[model samples]
Target: MKTKKFQGIVQVQYEQARQSIQTGDLLFCSGTYLISELIKKASNSFMSHVAFLFEWNGRVLVFESVESAGVRIIPLSHYVTNYNNTGRKYKGALYLARHETLIDSSFDRTLLQNMIGKAIGSLNRNYDQTELIRILTRISLGVGRHKENEAYICSEFVDQCFRQIGIRFPRTEAGFVYPEHIAADPHVYPMFEIVP
Candidate 1:
């Protein structure tokens, strides 16, 4: 049952992302999981996941809350680009976003990195199962939410990083902020496609 169409597809590579990304950048990821499909269907947006970047010891990494692994850190290269399934890695279609205002200031770099470090240390925490249900509910009812804590969702985790620095978004509700809103935020602009 082999098909010529299936063989025509090309795999992705790390260098192809074309990012001149700084130490700290926010990445909005379009996922391929079954849950991602549900999220995309609900939000009517290509993005389903959100992650933030951190540079440590000259290597860049991304930190986020994922449904399966909870809060974790992976090499930035792995975040945006494809990883051969034969190897040990997590891969997805990653789109990037950054707040130029913060990037331009060039102040508080150490403090920001320190805060992200603390959040990273909180890894292996639980992903918000309630939030997932809330997202599903919003899809059906067009309005739904549950209190957020103990477990963190992707957008919540990204928001918390800013909250720690006393930078709160205007509509700062964890359950209400979806990936689409994050991607559409005025400060966040599309960087480039990862070529998946």
Candidate 2:
């Protein structure tokens, strides 16, 4: 019952958040897990996770890589409906942004879906622990690169999609590209900021 009520209270906020996102837009989140704290420390940014939104047959889905699930596509409802890991719902803290330079027309729908398909297909793969550590280390010293691995970290997965069209993210040589880095670009416009 407690979980049900908690879900009810946050459901409205989730809906509001969903409305703010559009197809081809990017979403950044401030998570409550302990690792989130470390990610914030490593990246020196508020956001710990990022995902892109996709509208399919009237349902909004978010594609992201998570430590628990690696690279996967989830419905927007599943992404935001539940209370955060800390069991608290904060308002206006999470945000979604779109790159001003990212025009939807530049992408071929079939090719993009194929890319997403590749991610969906890679579900059997695991999250890249080595890459995660490399990201943290590189973020601190601003040097070194993660060796190629089959696993997926959130930022690397998202960045790969954008890289498909020849868009260089973060405009940096940093070893690990971060979610905050993507959302920080002047070209990325904030779509919604809800204060609950």
Candidate 3:
């Protein structure tokens, strides 16, 4: 892996992942911190910063920004390969499980709406709800109809994230249902309408 500079950001560029130090760059760093004091300070402050966990040179690195608008880029190869290349085996499993356990054809709009609400509520405790929703919405839109398993995996991962943050999520229903009215009633449940 080579550490390169992109637009004045210190970046570690690898075949699978890339890192950069730039303004507005959020890094979801994983692993133990060497300087606990600095980590504490950064964690307490930098609320507007974007950070995420990424691997570099086969090791995980904490990519942080000293300024705003800086982004640390990590190619998906660092985490997992493209689902298309794997014949969607992993994706299929995720979808079947979600469809069987979390969502099914018999589910009403209210249940789906409730699931979304619970998902959002769980995320709100740790990150900004608006931002999380934006991210999730983008992901959902990109998923389309063909990637059912991918969507299911994403939903399940989100639920797990909520749990990790000590947020309790409502039990999601099985199967998909329509009659959008259930989502329209604000008093009934919070709905995250996916826009096409």
By TM-score, who's the top model here?
1
Residue pairs in collision within model 2: 91-196, 92-194, 92-195
lDDT (C-alpha, whole model) for all candidates: 0.66, 0.65, 0.26
Candidate 1: tens digits of C-alpha lDDT, residues 18-73: 34656557776666778887787787766778888776776777888888788988
The list of candidate 1 runs beyond 4 A from truth reads 1-13, 16-19, 80-92, 170-175
Residues 1-196 of candidate 3 have per-residue lDDT tens digits of 0101111232233332232221111222221333222322432311112122333465543222221212223333332334225532211100000112222346343344443344334331322223333333444454212122212222233333323323333321322111111111121221111111
**lDDT by residue (tens digit), candidate 2, 107-168:** 55555565566556666577787888777668776767856567777877877776654555
List per-candidate RMSD values in Å: 7.0, 7.4, 20.3
- Candidates in order, TM-scores: namely 0.78, 0.75, 0.19
Better of 1 and 3 by TM-score: 1
Q: What ranking emerges by lDDT with the best candidate at the front?
A: 1, 2, 3
Q: Top model by lDDT, which number? A: 1
| Worst window of 10 by summed lDDT in candidate 1 | 1-10
Q: Which candidate, 1 or 3, has the higher lDDT?
A: 1
